[model samples]
Target chain A: MADEVKLFRTWSSPFALRIVWALKLKGIEFETIFEDLANKSSLLLQNNPVHKKVPVLVHNGKSVCESFVILEYIDETWTNGLPLLPKDPYERAEARFWAKFSDEKLWLSARGILFGVETEQAEARLQAIQNLQYLEEQLKGRKFFAGETIGFLDLAVGWMANLLSVLEEITGYVLIEEVKFPLLWKWMQDFSDVPVINESWPSRDKLVIKFQTMRDSYLAGKI
Target chain B: MADEVKLFRTWSSPFALRIVWALKLKGIEFETIFEDLANKSSLLLQNNPVHKKVPVLVHNGKSVCESFVILEYIDETWTNGLPLLPKDPYERAEARFWAKFSDEKLWLSARGILFGVETEQAEARLQAIQNLQYLEEQLKGRKFFAGETIGFLDLAVGWMANLLSVLEEITGYVLIEEVKFPLLWKWMQDFSDVPVINESWPSRDKLVIKFQTMRDSYLAGKI
Candidate 1:
């Protein structure tokens, strides 16, 4: 039986976009079901009842939720073209660790800078910058996070290549100065140049408007 | 050279204990270096500079940090033992998902019950119980999380078998009533009855005393 793959996603969610990049990179033909996160489709809720979030991959009647989990599923199931995770056990663990760090530490701290209160934004920005420095150190002399080509860690932090600038523009937080994080700056340019990634990114102008409104709501205590 | 395996752990930590259980279940010989979390050892700090936390498995002089990441590392590297994760791609994704849910949602909410302020305990307890309900439902007819044998998800949530009761005693909030979570209650009994888990648990009396002091500090605003 041929594989039937469908992804539940929002255009602007980096988590959802990770799945898109992975699938496209692997040359997998999958259907995309864009979700209105505000009024989520029943299909999404049914597939992912636990988190009720997007980036759920429905394949051959089974659904996999969570972007990281979905990414692993794609790599393991589609075993052709590009492997998302590395082949060696140790390298695989390192990829998982950095992917996790990207989400739990880097993204969480960065999100704080985007949405945190005025008094907390400075502290959040500092922590986010520190977290970015860790990535900079990791990227020292490497072409991409996975090295030579886009892999799990590259797709994991791919959002930063585009959305980060949008965040900085809205919040006036100078997060990724080239002088401070030269390697990361280079990585951003390199990551954005990947054909699959470049083609898959949401419109930057639209993302800026969307995030600007959300940040406004967060600052005004409306959401 | 023989695989030099060493696990950095703390006896009272559920996260660390998961590694101990994984190593023992795999029948791998290893050394254990207990860390004084208050004044962490340089080895622990150096090995896991990112998190500076325990449950680091150093195999052949290379270190893997993060309990979940380490668990995967052990399963992949050792291939001989009882498989920690399922062989199927979809099932593996499910195991990863629940393991994540166990930590991010279930344990986080339960920790709030143990350490959250008095005014917030009720809400935290409610959220923890709700999270447990999800686990209970997952265990409806299965002997263990992986069906017949103890697997990744079992080890992921193995802490509740011992520590939940201690937290309940410390906070005066009953989380797992037998009537409310009968399946979970049975899983707890079955999980504790496993030989490795049964033998490896810290003394209940010591845990009670330790948590009581920690809770006192939390209540007193000292920690």
Candidate 2:
């Protein structure tokens, strides 16, 4: 009823959940429309014609696509909420660099280990470890990538909290070890402890089931 | 002297030039240290250890890497000049979307045509045209991507002004035509017509010489 916020998303999509966490953190209530990734809804297609992907936040009829962009929009619109970005321009740029880094370098490496062939998986595992180490260094002196608060960068990379464990279980590749990534490991725990995120996040069981199916399909050459 | 801004860049780099234009548009005077790509300066390596690439803006001893991030940093830091981003949240998101689109989709396609093998070049040419058409539709009635004034999106896609011609010269693949992309053609001219851009831009003959060498190297398997 308030601002007619509608989120076009898929339940299992970590990208879409980023928007969900942002919206909840802002204390803005929105109706969620779950989408089938295989057959995207016309509304999603019409709203986000370019990517045809989920997590299109349609607020008062206008659509904002891309999870990070959507998060920025939500932060700007609801100025009263806990701020997602820093007030300082340089700090904001630093936050942005890390968020882009998380997406550009981190996610792909994790995906490779999860779905790649044997040799590829081994290479990807090393890449993932190196990326995690960088994240560990970034998180060393701070509670979150954005400092003591849960901010934009944390939410952007928060999927690893649950997904990493599920991936480890499925692939038997223990990437994010506590000893190796103490800061990142603590950051993961701190990120999941957020009430809204914990509430909105898909259960580990849900992710495990879906990922297992995906892995089986990939191994069988069906996907 | 004022906050000590230094830019690490190369003369021929489009990415580095983006920072140059941003700094110019803001009227923020800075010294440029040209770096040879083959033998990158230790300062460049130290500043942007992740990418080890050009166009790192160091202000007051702090480094901000990535062209778009630097642009945003400049816009936010200096509020006196023509604002690069729109005031409204939605408009800003739209601008960001297109900027990302131009980088993710358009750049790859242009690279494909410029340096990719024959088969890859043909496929990439089609992709580039389709992307340009989408951009043309976006520029339908507006004078600029950010309405009447040149902004981030314009700067993001400004390479077509100089580089596209050189690419066409080298590959003999003409992707942007006046007949098909009247709006974009006009936009390109308007972008290049900017006093700051025109004044600071590298000569077309210079780009031709550079790209000719690059194309030859690619064909000879020397790259």
In order, the Cα lDDT scores of the candidates are: 0.91, 0.89
> How displaced is residue B105 in candidate 1, in Å?
1.0
Off by over 4 Å in 1: A117-119, B117-119
- Give the 10-residue window scoring lowest on summed lDDT in candidate 1 chain B: B214-223
Q: Estimated TM-score per prediction?
A: 0.96, 0.96
Worst 10 residues of 2 chain A by lDDT: A214-223
| Span of 10 residues, lowest total lDDT, candidate 1 chain A | A214-223
Off by over 4 Å in 2: none
Query: Distance from true position, residue B186, model 1, in Å?
Result: 1.5
lDDT of 2 by residue, A1-223 (tens): 5699999999899999888888888889899999998999899999999889988999999999988889889989999988999899999998888889889888999989888878999999998888887788888789998898889988899899999999999999998778888998888888888898799878779899999888888878944
State the TM-score of the second chain for every model: 0.96, 0.95
**Decoy 2 TM-score against native:** 0.96
Compute the lDDT of residue A184 as modeled in candidate 2: 86
lDDT of 2 at A202: 87
Clashing pairs in 1: none
Give per-residue CA lDDT, model 1, range B1-223, as digits (tens). 8889999999888899999999999999999999999999999998999899998999988999999999999999999989999999998998999999989998888878878876677788888988998899889789899998999999999999989999988878888889999989999999999999999999999999999998788779954
